[model samples]
Target: MRLGRVFSVIAVCFFVSACSWFGGDEKRLPDIPEQQLYDEAITALEQQEYETAVEKLQMLEARYPFGRYSEQAQLELIFAYHKNFEPEAARAAADRFIRLHPSHENIDYAYYLKGLTAFEQDQSMFQRFLPIDIDQRDPGAARSSFESFSTLINRYPDSSYAPDAQKRMLFLKNRLASYEVHVANYYMKRGAYIAAANRGRYVVENLKETPATPDALAVMYQAYELLGEQQLAQSARDVLLANYPNYPLKSYKVKNTSLLETATFGLFGSESEADDPPRPTTEDKQGLEKPENEAQKEQETKRPWYHKATFGIFE
Candidate 1:
């Protein structure tokens, strides 16, 4: 009985080995002709099969590196990667194309694609509908996108993509300026008055004319006030008031709270609670508070020069 069982086990093992030898893996599709592969990739792209298009384009590039369709295939690969949501691959392909054919007629397209890829990469799905402020997030990708678009604009001013690139650059500039303000705000919240003031000053000096400029000035004013730099605070406030008359600076003052009130968490404080009703200020009494027309004017002034020049077409 033991001998019969061992023979059966041996037979089962041999059958398993035979099955593995014959049915290892499915065969790969035969290599398609370069022209056929390119056509297929285009067809897949039209069909919105981005993954298949990327695969076919990559294969076409590998199989026909120097073929007649090579240059076109390389360019298509960047778009394919982008459509497939592979931003890093798209950027790499674009860079490669630009490096390989710097004087190519389609070089501007590569630059535009690089910039677009960077722009898309920086955009989060949450930003589409959420009220999230992009300034609070990392600005690395935004900076890169801005640089890429700037390069495209400077190098190919007359290119078809230049107009769009210029528009994106304006947005990126404002975004970066806002990011600086966000950092300054963070420092202010942490009581790092000097650092906050420096960041705010940086935005005012380096990112002039951006929508965040007024906010940057406000931050600088508040930070300097907290740091006891009354002169600097006054300077910032003057600039902010001059440029943005409707900017609300009434809330920038530091509240005076006694140590006893601080230690007691305001329960036994002499000062009124923050939520309690308060008397109107001098501006309110003088009818110099923010008016609806002033708010509208603020919005109008905040529009970038391009937006004004384009008559809100780009906005």
Candidate 2:
């Protein structure tokens, strides 16, 4: 009796599922009607109905997998997602198109769409422009955009989008270099001279082709000198000279501490001419100080008048 009851229950469940699948007034997914489905999807996309367009384009892809408009549908769907601010979906569609049709006539546009998706996926202005948060350092989205755009540039140098991609690439490149320089300057301001020098060195080594090269080299020279790395400072100076001969490295002033200290102390005492181990003087000493030493003594004797008056003492 229990087995019969179990069989009856199973039969009822299967019957309900079948009914729902075929008889519950659910619109049967239509067959791929070549141009009609494609046109409908395009219309949906044009009407800004991205979800509906995606549904239709997905049906077209499934039903007419190798149809003439299959790739076009896929590409348009990417644009639809992008237009709707659905960056992830757009990126996925673009990637799928590229994987499936690497050499498609519209492959450049596909890659460009990937870059656009990446660019759009970035955070808003508050996160990017505000100094209160670390969102400014979030390089993942920006780097992806740059890399995708760079790929397009390298692969399709003659593509119509090449110029735009190149411009974006330069902007991203400069942004990254500026980030490095900011860090270096931070270290410099904190008196972390070695750290600042190292950061600048990394830029010169890795980002020589960038606009930040000259600034990086200049900062590095200053940092090296501050850290007393004279050799490295000289090397940086040479690089600056070689790249920018008229930049005037000599104009950058650095103090001579030793000379400064000596000059500060020397004003208190006059140099003794006879202190040089009794150099033969024109006048005989006669057990007295030599003439040069006497001359210095006489000059020293005057005490510049100001010193004797202030200290109330004589030499």
Query: Can you give the TM-score per candidate against the true fold?
Result: 0.69, 0.62
**Which candidate achieves the best lDDT against the true structure?**
1
Q: Candidate 2 has which clashing residue pairs, if any?
A: none
lDDT score of residue 213 within candidate 1: 95
Model 1: runs farther than 4 Å from truth? 1-29, 251-315
lDDT of 2 by residue, 271-295 (tens): 3334444556556556455467677
Highest TM-score: give the candidate number.
1
Clashing pairs in 1: none
Predicted structure 2, TM vs. truth: 0.62
